[model samples]
Target chain A: DAGVTQSPTHLIKTRGQQVTLRCSPKSGHDTVSWYQQALGQGPQFIFQYYEEEERQRGNFPDRFSGHQFPNYSSELNVNALLLGDSALYLCASSFGVIRLGQFFGPGTRLTVL
Target chain B: AQTVTQSQPEMSVQEAETVTLSCTYDTSESDYYLFWYKQPPSRQMILVIRQEAYKQQNATENRFSVNFQKAAKSFSLKISDSQLGDAAMYFCAYRRRNAGGTSYGKLTFGQGTILTVHP
Candidate 1:
């Protein structure tokens, strides 16, 4: 069975531009969560989606949003990207509960130039 | 607010040796979970081991184990018989245990510690 998969292994954008990163959850999983990992730092929670609706969010601003499809895949969209927005975007999927732990993807490296 | 802290920014050890990575967290909630995740150059976060705050027994996973001290709010991971493959960034994370079990699934992570294993 495949684990979580993310598209666009790398991305380059400019300030004020928008970028969308995609992710497909592992088979048999229904929830998807996104994280941002700045250079040399651990991953920070962005938001989580279950049943196609956002169930929880982090301290991020409105410029960062996400969507979850019926298939359980997810998209993280960052608008008005700043140089600080450049980071590794990770996608994780879990079962119904958080205790099950989360399985993460390889993550997409975003560089805002 | 919950916060996880990994004081060691980097550590080095020889293969076949044991190395312990330190982690400490602060949370007002009594019931929660602590985790150690390994992120290799591949950038995939791999679950090393996890400990539930309510459980007094330290969790053990093969060559990996955790020392979870509830009162001290400390959770440390020890890697035994370390291998070159163990060289990577290790992260400490905390997740609040919601009574509903469905809400607040987000994880708060600490700054990672880069581990270097020598042959």
Candidate 2:
């Protein structure tokens, strides 16, 4: 059973540019959640996706959005990137909407210049 | 606006010793869950332990155990016989219970505690 997997372990983009980070959940998982962790801070909730639909979102602005595919994989898209957006974006997967013990990916370290 | 807070920004413990990291949370809802996640330099969030709001008994896994105080809204984690592998950033998180176990989970996390295990 493969654990959660994220692509483009590191990303660099200029301000105003857009970036997309990807995640594949562990097998048998159906829900995916995205989080942003700034340096020296814990991961902050971004949004959660289940059954290809966004179920809940955090205080993040419209600049942060996400999608969950039928296979339960997910992508986090950040638009109009600001230097503040430079952080580690983590994707966590669970077996269901109420599942505990979410498994997180290694995360994509985004650096916005 | 539920919030979780970890008072300790950094902590160090000698190998084979015991250490406790403190955590406190503020929430209006009575039903919820608390979690402790460890992130090492690799940055993979690993579930260390979890406690349910309804359960009075603390949760334990291996050498890790939690001191959950529902009335105080406090959840502290204790690691016994700590090893070098225990050194990591420990985050305290909260998730309100969702209907039917939908797992529509959104965690409110504290500004994590950095644990250093000296051998």
Candidate 3:
């Protein structure tokens, strides 16, 4: 009955560098989605992965990519990061694509210098 | 495109009292879902309550309830007998019911409101 879990609670990277954040979805869940929450702001959807394939994406650029493993875990990779990229990266999991209400993780705080 | 808005940036209420947080969203889709998520200082996003567009009855969870107005496109959360633990960042989000393919499971969130429960 574990909830969604994320790794690297906090990270710091310089501009132009790349970073990868990980997430383990809740038990019995198969869909994973990533979101970026900037300071004093709500989370913005990044992308969603289902069945080891990307099923949906937000308005994010190509630099932001993600992958879903067979086990339903996910990784969010941000390449050539900028200072504005610093934010709390959250992961949410649901039973399937049709379930809009998701369970979210504690999130990874990323600081791009 | 769907958009959520929480006009109030911050609000405070005394402990054991009641408080209401406002949330409004813009969407062209007739059928969808609206959600209220509570993010505590620990930064964990917890779902408070949700309402379906097609449901006329408001959604309620324990002391938390929503005032959903489909025509007005408004969804407000009311917390009764609030406690210190109720202090957190409240976010309003929306999702289209007919979403499929690359749009499935995506949520559009509002700017958020910071609720402070005074003890």
* Predicted model with the maximum TM-score: 2
Model 2: C-alpha RMSD to truth?
Answer: 1.0
Cα lDDT tens digits for candidate 1, B1-119: 99999999999999999999999999999988888999999899998888888889999999999999899999999999999999999999999988877634889999999999999
RMSD of 3: 1.8
State the DockQ of every prediction: 0.70, 0.78, 0.61
Clashing pairs in 3: none
**For candidate 3, what is the DockQ?**
0.61
Q: How accurate locally is residue B102 in candidate 1, as Cα lDDT from 0 to 100? A: 67
Evaluated on chain B only, what are the TM-scores of all the candidate structures, in order? 0.97, 0.98, 0.95
lDDT of 2 at B20: 99
Model 2: per-residue lDDT, tens digit, B13-92?
99999999999999999899899999999999998888888899999999999999999999999999999999999999
- Candidate no. 1 TM-score: 0.97
Candidate 2: docking tier: medium
TM-score of chain A of each: 0.97, 0.96, 0.95
Stretches of candidate 2 off by over 4 Å are A97-99
- Name the lDDT of candidate 1: 0.92
Ten-residue segment with the worst summed lDDT in candidate 3 chain B?
B96-105
Better of 1 and 3 by lDDT: 1
